[model samples]
Target: MLVPLTRQKFNQLIPLIATGPQYKYYWGKFPDFLQRLLISVVIAAVYVLVRLFAMPGFGPILFVLGVIGAFYWLWGPVFWASMRNAKCRRYKYSGFFRGRVLDWWITDELIGKQETVDNKGDLVIVENREKRINLEVGDETGFTAQLRAPLRVEHKVIARGQKVEMLVMSNRPDLSKIEEITDIYIPSRDLWVSDYPYLRRDYFPEVSRRLRDRPSERPRRRRPPEEQKGRRVEEWE
Candidate 1:
């Protein structure tokens, strides 16, 4: 049965998932806070050295302070990653549902360029197009939910009048978020990133454990590997 996602739950999920102005979610770029953490490590080393030499008893305090600095710096990205995995899990599992894209619209809002790796492992650019897409999803139960997608053309598979398989929040079985636009159809890409909720049981879990768990979904050589042995492997369009 299709689980429902409530509007309220989606609201809470947003601030938790939108890691930064950078759209690394679609792009394979590391977490935004990663830079900050790297800087913190350097700062911590310098900071500890100064405090330890400047005062004896205060060494512990200085160390504590430095550790705190690292905590906050790492916290944001870690938290976001965890929550995103959680949602992804539900999306691939319990939240399994289906719906259709009633309509879609683009927004003028654009963030700076962010790097997102395509299935080809090429570093593709993901501009924050923030296409404001609204979809009306319905199931055999005659239940429907209005969903909005915050992703842009490059990051999403959504299109008007397209049938989609999606997942809802465990608690709220009516409203859904834009990320839940699982069964998306990108006309330009000509492939379904999400076709139905019947993905492998390990889909989300595999990703959570390792980013490289699944091979790139990008279309690879259609010909058998043996056939392409001597020539360049032609990519699927």
Candidate 2:
């Protein structure tokens, strides 16, 4: 049972949108090759030792064991690294629907900030400020939707005052899917710093000047009466 988001809930989620730290594939090199070579060498050495001890059959068994060990060692790291990368990857989407349909695809931070607990022990929270989403286990009744187990969430800290965007979805009454809450439009360091040196420095400063300043309202620009009238007349025209 998917429900439309209200305006008030949408406004609350505006602050949660932003990009996150880029993940680097650390084991993208030939570490596995070295591990396999090492295993093969060890196995061959063991086979030679067994042959010298009058055990010809043991040599073949050791060779087979070595081959199996080499494969396991070679691919084990690659498989584990790939799984880690996939789990950390983020997805963002626009809207949600009922009956196990695919929603939007997001590549940003999604957060579930718990706001309250209902009688059934479900968590009710504001999802991206567009709607109040709930998360709970068990049957979906008197609720908009429901999500099963295996829910995940991630938390990150950015420089304060950084602009972010957020997307929220209610998979179940107790679970609210929160998406990336950072300004994705901001260029990455490798991109901007290499091409635009001056602009790069402005993107991320060690000490934010705005944070150092005392709190003060920005001065409002006063338009002249004639300009205001002109703007109004232009709107009508």
Candidate 3:
């Protein structure tokens, strides 16, 4: 069922959203505007020093520095403001529902069927039924990078009934603070249309095919004997 995300649920799942370490580091050290301003000032000073001593130039240097200072002053506050807005939006839209009425399950028997390799070139299987989604998260490089993660999933729509399709749209937790709604896919009516500008399906097909075709317990390819011996020697050395 489709429902609005409540504050209580937001508080509960906020930790599971897979926030990168950089978000925590920045969120903690500069929670206040004053600290951000001070840090910007320090950075601007360093830039000015480099310009004055290392790359002394014409009037353009000062002009560039001025523009940089302006950006520095606005960047931190703008970022925090966007973050606050995103949290509110996420609380407003987060929930559990299906993308369509096709009646799908995570395949309880094959949850957390990760493929790993051991030192002996043998495949190892670890069963974890507690995990919900089969997602591989990447490390965050910066604020822009962090925002891209949520944006990726912001374009998937949900359909509950025969003709009703609810578009799922929300705010990004970082920059690029645009409200985006995904395409609606109503399978019963055979209707599908995207409101978002860019809509492309590439990885979904390959992943779906793999999951549907093979058993989760399938073993991965083993490394050659020569490669295994080389790895062992390297480890010892």
Candidate 4:
């Protein structure tokens, strides 16, 4: 299901920049007001303390640095999200496509390790690890892509051959071909899996359904050879 991009549809996605789950990774689950309060307190303290103790020449330099740091800590994540959102504008068209999960697995990733002294005065190495889910999905075009995401509770239910939906982007006005893909939405489970939430999902299901039900015919393409069924490995860039 494909559709030509419109100014209205484009503006609707703008909220995703700040509301995406990826923002939690940057600043945690704290509420917006609480986060801003904490940042303000810290910045005020830095400004006051630096001015009180630093020597004449050094005080101005430290104050300037403090202001810069404050601005970054307050707005850095938003700035990054804005850049990503701007980048998406290059795709003049967008659409949803269906695929089946061909395979899935979990892997333990070592994040970091810290060396510490135990109560017994013995040295201990504490390791930090994260679990990630890896999925390989294929669409009707015979193209497959490997998607990796931080494992969540909902992901445990994902299985081979389960239907999956993804957002595809195209530069062409007609949406004749895909230029890039981002964000995977699992309709069965009502779950979204992605490193970053790129779609305004509230509008996704309806849009996908409407397009699929439209009377226009999709362009035809040759199917993969029968012998290649077990060996199909074409990947989309």
Against the unseen true structure, what C-alpha lDDT does each candidate score?
Answer: 0.46, 0.32, 0.36, 0.68
Evaluate model 2: give its TM-score.
0.23
Across 64-183, the per-residue lDDT of candidate 3 in tens digits comes to 765677466455544553464354345344321123243222223333477789999999987755412111111121111001111223224322223323323334221122243333
TM-score of each: 0.40, 0.23, 0.23, 0.64
Per residue, candidate 2 scores C-alpha lDDT tens digits across 1-237 of 222233333323222222122211222337645765677677667656665785666767766765665465444545554444333232322221221111212133343455888889998785542221122211122222222212123112222222211122332222233332111211222111111011112233311222224264332222444444434211000
The candidate maximizing TM-score is 4
Count of residue pairs whose backbone atoms collide, per candidate: 10, 37, 0, 0
The all-Cα superposition gives candidate 2 an RMSD in Å to the true structure of 20.2
Q: Write the per-residue lDDT of candidate 4 for residues 41-111, one digit (tens) a residue.
A: 68878788878988888877787777766666566677667677778766666655677898888999997
Alpha carbon lDDT of residue 136, candidate 2?
A: 23
Candidate 4, which segments miss by more than 4 Å at Cα? 1-11, 14-16, 20-22, 29-77, 87-95, 120-123, 170-180, 216-237
Ten residues in a row with the worst lDDT in model 1? Answer: 194-203
RMSD of 3: 22.1
Give the Cα-based TM-score of candidate 4 against the true structure: 0.64
